[model samples]
Target chain A: MSDGPAIETRGVTRVFESRKGFLFREKTRTEALKGVDLVVERGAIFGLLGPNGAGKTTFTKILSTLLLPTSGTALVLGHSVTKETAWLRPRMGLVLGGERGLYNRVSGRENLRYFADLYGVPIAERERRIGEVLERVGLTDAADRRTEEYSRGMKQKLHIARGILHRPEILFLDEPTIGLDPKSARETRKLIRSLVSDGVTIFLTTHYMFEAEELCPRIAILSRGRIVARDTLDGLRTLVGGDRTFEVEAYGFEDREIESLRHLPGVSKVASEEYGPATRLTMRVRTRETTLDDVRGLLPGHPELAVRERRTSLEDVYLDLVEEEAT
Target chain B: MAASAPAYTRARSTVASLRLAVLQFMADPQWLIPSMIAPVIFGLVSFELFRGYGPYFLIYAILGAGMMSMWGQTLYGSGWATGQDRNFGTLEPTIQSPTPYLYVVLGRVLWNVVSGLFGGLIVYAVVVGAAGQPPALANPLASIALFVFVMLTLAAIGVVFAAFYVYTRYAGFIQNIGEFAFYVGTGCMFPVVLLPFAVTPIALVFPPTWALDALRYVAIPGYTGFGWGLWGDVAGAVASTAVYLAIAGLIFRRVERQVLAKGNLSDY
Candidate 1:
């Protein structure tokens, strides 16, 4: 076992040069990844969550040694990411985006065998591992089919198989379930869990929060090339600083009632919406010993009110973080 | 078997990649099918028209058609295939793998050569049987040797063209140029003997030209029958093919490095 984290980055930056035209006069520089530091513990399912164009792919590329960072340093399994790529590449498997990473002309079996060889997998063990991965990814039946005829999901599964061919110490899956049906997406998540159980660490970048909530034990929210939050799902919930919000609908239409609820001691933010025949009010309040007690006390005054407390979820926390950043 | 050390892991991986390349070619019979048909089409319609001139015409057509098959299917075919791979970004996973880049390139080039050989044999059969003027082997063993050298040379040429496709982004242009060169240099319609002495020397420098004459001496009807010995043509073609192969190999390595350094391999 390694003493440090499976993946670690310190002030890593990846800058890409955009050269335009034949003469090469017009040049622009875009910083895809800017001085970012992160760490992933061994055997942990880590999620990198970010909006589109948030440099998640750039960060993943640098960490996987596919692209060299302009500045800063990253280490994968105690190997310098920038230097010693040949030694480092075999130990870390990567699944890039889209179906483009695979050879369409070969059968899935042959494709896997070819990649296995590139990873230096022994011949005797190659077939065994290939069989295991194909079955694990539910591609055993289609293994002999040419990849050109494979559907998007099948190609992605094969991509995953190729990534883990050499049993790399750490796996980097970028948008692994980007274009998959619900069933396939769930299966992919299950596969990730299975890999983690096998002691293979996973560092994944996904835009789907449910994926993060369902798969990643610890998640990092990357916004604008920086990590705004990195914690367990439960920790993120606490960090958002919002408690269970109740949306109450009452038949009685009264402005004074709304005013009184807004002035409650624990209520931090109040939002109101129309609920058919009644008014639906949502309050984001700090949880105190008497918070529910306070709501209960106010509810009795309005006889027509039907009070229901809504459970705060990961999505709610995510929206809160996004809205806070917007302000 | 007892457990062995991991020294041969890389070699096994290279072989596996080569197998994958072969699998890719086999998976798409459409690619090979057309290459097989092109040579026959040229042989039937074009080669027959040139037969009245001399035995040299029939032999030249046969050899030219054979070279065309290899140059078109192997060299130009590899160019188009590699271009497609680059456009699709399939090279990313390949380059990222631990296998040396040279093995990757060689595996792909070898696949082209295999396809080219198949195409050459099919064309050779059509030209010899259909034209009713098959060229005899000047020295059967030497002819076989020349075929090996010539195919290797053509495969190397294919590597160079594949590299060029990475930069041009239009591999079809290479295929067109290759087809034209096949017709002109190999004297498929006009034998180099019809050209002036100065032009003959220049045309003879092309691999296909040398290959056409060599095949004619051994496989076709003209050269060995006319006092030009089989060994002379075989040796000359072999030397020229060797030189072409060496240059092609250098170009393949150079372009590969440039493509990797510029990160243009993934460019569509």
Candidate 2:
């Protein structure tokens, strides 16, 4: 509701310390987030892509005011998440959905009704709003069915319904489409778009590269508790090297042939690695001037060489950044 | 300062939570079976022990049995629901809502009092059946009202103990171990005046101990639990219960902050 960014963090960190041993207790502190800084604008579907244990959920939990950061600060709607939770909770929603997090014995409608009251939905429109969210999530038919009988996809839809039932200004969805079928995942993505169309800022975390590329105009890649890169899709495409890559494979390449391939037009960088019995040279080209034929021409001595050109994708950028951080 | 929900909002949430508890109880009434076991056993055993002592002794047997039933249903029932929340993974979403979790506990305890009264009636029937007659009360109406008031005091205890469940998932196990200790310490099955002087201070800390003592004064003829009589015990009960209610908010705030810091809200 403020003019500032919808979500922002400054050097936020979270460490989880657990104790073991009944008598001489031993402490184990796992730093889940290490000095992460991020900014998300309003009305944007900002995608956060990270591998397992990469701190995506931790950062989201901090931003949503579900967990306090061990150090630094996080602001949602320009209010401190730790200090101003009362103002933040009503305006924000979260979906940490699974088979759990639901009243399995109650009907989906009943679950929404309970949350509608807790969220303080207007008495005049509580039932109507629940109906709208259920319809939007494609669960009208299953609305009265006990949630324990719901399929994984149906339960997920119900989770989404409860999250948007109150119509929060921002929503934090951690892997909303994780366990859904292909069709269901696509429909979930469509729902995300519709939510953004309604002017709700979305902080989405997922492992689906294509989903992030398709939905988020801006994205961030988190690796091992740290954010390695954050930018527009094209911006991330540029970060790893360029917008195009050519994978040239041959049994082996001579020193001169490898050196000559690197000098080709628009080639910004060349990386070599063993692929099965052959050696693959990955050339990152920043321009359209380089073609597969141009690469084949340079290595004519090896007629068996296979040249494959692929446009740079978010997945490529993600792997490159995460690996870069790892090394 | 954090913004507080409007009074109406809090009240509505509390009512909604109470409704949810009722709905859940209706769906699964089997939980009532375990809570009934202890009270029925106590009623039968105490009736046998107090038989033929005196006409007033039957009053002790009945009040002691009813108090045991109300004790479990009010304190243990409310806390168990929170343990179930941890199991259902409902704790996190409920905690995340703008409505403070304390109101939710209040709602559940309110419903428990309803169920606990049902439990108290069942125990009363069991005792009367064992004794082959109903216990005579000097003032039945005042005793009934005071008995209901004693349930409210037990509710204060419930709300306070519910904070422990929110603090740790293992709270149910600890409560299980401490259940008998709570009964003996609070003197739910006997008069606190019979306890050692050193232990009386600890027993008086629980509002139900004083409230039950006051209820006895009005229920039993020639009964004097304390030298000052019914009004004195009533004063003590009201003051102690007020203290419990006052500190519940502070305790819940600290527990909530601790769980959030530990990131253990979802742990079961």
Candidate 3:
């Protein structure tokens, strides 16, 4: 691999077209990606988070050379996905981990062995590498069993085992931990982190906010086929609102009272939700300029009031940014 | 950091996937029963129909039924494997690998030739049992070589049609629709002479038409297909097979690009 960002895209766009109707067969086009520009440094765990149709998988597919971009450009390890795939494919690994990607009748080891040869893993070390990957994924015991009998999590682990079997320089993992139990997901995250420490750049996409926050040092949020935000959690925290959120609950609060809370010093935004008889005002505060006492004081008329302060979670940040884009 | 491995070689991928195909077949070998049902019936029916054609009738039955079975496995085997990859969602990763997809495909084709031989045996057993005797060949060794050659020709055609599967996930449907057309066009059940004069040119396009004709000329004493004799039939089969092999190599590159461009490699 040449020297450059592990992954980079310049306004990359992908449009998918399909024909419908029996007689007319009108063509309908769906733009899966819209001019996405991003960069991922080498050896870092970069995460992509998105809604179901937000095109996270499409971006991963383009970078991994599985699909061609309709316009713009995507490069992996300084090689264009479109023209330099021959140079890029061997150095890149993709784990689209799901129930579908494995041969049901073959053993898990056989699946990895097949990919090892396809990726040109050295013949002398092929078996050892397959064994090691199976062990790393905690699948050594199940390696010889036919994959058809393996559970979804085991099949997912097999997907990961095949992905890292060749020791690629950059790995594209599209929701690698999806569908696994918490313990398996944690182990998979640990494996991903270990891969990063071993100098493999990881481009991860996941719906699990905590997973991304725990594993990815930097992340990009894709909303509506465009990247709404890309930065460290703190950076995104600032972009969405702040690193601190204050939750205030009461029987009720007036619109003017809510507006006053939104205008308070250090308050970036205020959102309200009703749960049965009570209302909760979620205030994103950037600094200590606003406190729980201040929120409580603004709604002093309510006898039943509960106020607390907590650090903004990644989920809060994600919803803030994605909701903003939705509006 | 782990040391990255080198690029894949065509030979190793071929062997590895060929082994995979056999392992998978062994794992769920029952599919073999369904695949043979049609050919076995065709063989038994051909035996009854050809029983009155004299001593040469047995050779006719064997050639007809054996070629039919080989035609199914050798031609549909690789395409079926590709379609299976699409369903299993394994096609995405396999296509993503550095090894050109054709090598992986060639592995399946080669394995199919082996399994296709098993198919031929099934048909042969059915026909021979129905005849209550083995077919007498004018030149048994020559006929054997020609039978294997016919299989290779079918394999060549198979390799090319396999490209169709790699090109689209719906290839199985398309191939299914064209299957009987192919059987008739390739003259798998009989000689190309039986096809219409206008369709003869289309029949000659497939390597099996020439090859099966060549095998019959060797196995039957008075068989004179196309009046070209055995050597001409052999030469025609060789040229057509070579052409098909060359097309297989070229078609894959184009199909790979087409599928990638359409973003439909995973559409199944």
Leading candidate by TM-score: 3
lDDT of 2 at B112: 93
Q: Quote the TM-score that chain A achieves in each candidate.
A: 0.86, 0.95, 0.97
Considering summed lDDT, which 10 consecutive residues are worst modelled in model 1 chain A? A284-293
- Model 3 residue A123 lDDT score: 91
Misplaced by over 4 Å in model 3 are B1-5, B34-40
Q: By TM-score, is 2 or 3 better?
A: 3
Candidates 1 onward: DockQ, in order = 0.30, 0.46, 0.73
lDDT of 2 by residue, B1-268 (tens): 1133312288988999999998888777586574567678878887887878887778888877877778888999888889889999999889999999999999999999988888788778888888788889999999999999999999998888889999998898888998887788787877778888777888889898888888888988887876668888889999999999889889999989988899988889
lDDT of each: 0.72, 0.87, 0.87
Instruction: Give TM-scores of the second chain, every candidate.
Output: 0.75, 0.92, 0.94
Q: What clash count goes with each model?
A: 6, 0, 0
If you assessed candidate 2 against the hidden native complex, which CAPRI class would it receive? acceptable
TM-score of 2: 0.95
Misplaced by over 4 Å in model 1 are: A16-30, A97-100, A148-151, A243-286, A290-311, A323-327, B1-11, B87-89, B164-267
Error of 1 at B248 (Å): 7.2
Could you say which candidate leads in DockQ? 3
**Interface C-alpha root-mean-square deviation, candidates in order:** 4.9, 4.5, 1.7
Q: What DockQ class does candidate 3 belong to?
A: medium
